[model samples]
Target: MFYDSYLYLVDGSYLPTVAPTGLKTDLGCWKYHFGAIEGMRQNGWTLWTVILIRLVAEEFNFKLSIMGQGDNQMLLIEFTETLPEEVTVNQVNQFISALEEKLSYIGPPLKIEETWISKDYLLYGKFPIKNRVALTTSWKKNCRMFRCCNEDFPTIETSLSSLAANLYAAVASDNVTQPIFFLSISDGHNQQFSLFLVIYQ
Candidate 1:
């Protein structure tokens, strides 16, 4: 089963963090995931974990993290675990409190904006467009835009770095005169959404 959760910044200016769930593992097995976690920690980024619980006939628990400084940063971490059927609100609050306390030593205090417990979601992908005229002319003609699953997206750090590099390259080249921004479109059923990063002249 593939479990996923998205954390959107309330401001809507930055790309939301997408976390695909991973199997729960023990601390002794940290070597498997520690490299990525440690690299972010060493770079002075704060990590905040968000837990999403879905309750139906059975309870499904998904964990993901947000990393940043002050209020403008995000990252992804994934963990999957099952909660006891009889868990109570008090127990859940206690767990969250403990998690926040544990993470305080490493960086800023963990702030959880919200918890999403929904069964319906839209699978997201990315499609890049290089021509502005093609979008205005005909959607049918531009059907060949490159598309890939969300899991295939570069890490937030990598995406930002790449965007910065591209901006610098565009500035240095006299031939490049287009601006880039993302356009997200959802299907009528809202079951799937695609993000188009358009670079137009």
Candidate 2:
């Protein structure tokens, strides 16, 4: 027989014959690694990226984190959070655009990316320019520069770090805290909204 076949006794009778084909069992070792998480943790940082973006969503926060990156290409991001049901992917993108507009003072346009994370959305941003040293502090009274199109961005009242970490902790820890600065865009009075951000360096 050209093909292998099994023979078995049925009703006290021999069934069939078989060919000489055979199979081997040993399989070579497979090695897989995720250097991203390992490196981030070692560098005293972590990426809080979202894992999923669902169709019908409600009550959540969503953003990506690039932490302790030594260079531009090698970045580790972890997205984590949920959003209210009324918000859609398109609306989130619009909000991201607004943030880009607000941070225009930093220079270079922002390149945005949305990834899926645990039935939620993971928002990521890439600055067109690189090698910019970033410092995060609470809104210091001296460096506060916040305002809507109607009013100039007020000078920050806390260090950028303090403000940033507080926001991250609030969302990461699920504790709500009023943001120190809000941007209303084109108008400062009625359009204001608080936000938490993860800056890439």
Candidate 3:
């Protein structure tokens, strides 16, 4: 239930928390952490599997991981370690294969990666949908339905959670009395993600 929103694996070598349990708990104990990390060389299969469903369950709670990226802003997650040879370590691989299998005619694999996400990237807070934006159980991260900019927010510095909270409060005043969004940022890692409800007037 807690493993939704945007999921990522902090390259263990660089992340402050070698285990990456998050601020709420230690990594060894958190189910989400355990699901994603498998000793550094690979992770994020199950974490990715759980993202959408978790977002749909209640309010949106975002998850993030910090990894070192070069000036190109690209992150290379070596899928080399847990190659999808066996179903045991192939959870994410299976998830991707199933989805791709279904949409085989759609012209791609079921799994899609963000070309590069930057510190300055404003995820769920970038636009006031519709001028008509709608969440409608859509992941909507890279969808043209919401506005994403080519610009990047400065990774070295930010206050995204506060900003997201303010935006949510501003949007949901009447109907959704208790909508909540939880955002956790690595004080050191510089990546931010938000989970927000689209208030329908």
RMSD of each: 21.8, 25.4, 21.8
Assess each prediction's global lDDT (C-alpha) against the native. Answer: 0.34, 0.32, 0.33
TM-scores of all candidate predictions against the true structure? 0.21, 0.19, 0.16
Task: Compare the candidates by TM-score and give the number of the best one.
Answer: 1
The alpha-carbon lDDT assigned to residue 141 of candidate 1 equals 21
- Give the candidate number with the greatest lDDT: 1
List candidate 2 stretches off by more than 4 Å.
1-64, 67-91, 112-201
Ranking by TM-score: 1, 2, 3
| Candidate 3 local lDDT, 1-201, one digit each (tens) | 246422434566433333354443343233343253344432343344334323332221223232322211122122344445353335434433444454454322233454322223322433322323343322222121112223364322234444444435444532332332222223112333321222222
Clashing pairs in 1: none
Please, what are the lDDT tens digits per residue for candidate 1 over residues 18-87? 3365323332212223223234343334223222111110232434434333333332323333645345
Candidate number that wins on lDDT, 1 or 3: 1
Candidate 3: stretches off by over 4 Å? 1-88, 106-111, 114-201
User: What lDDT, from 0 to 1, does candidate 1 have?
Assistant: 0.34
Residue 170 CA displacement from its true place in model 2, Å: 43
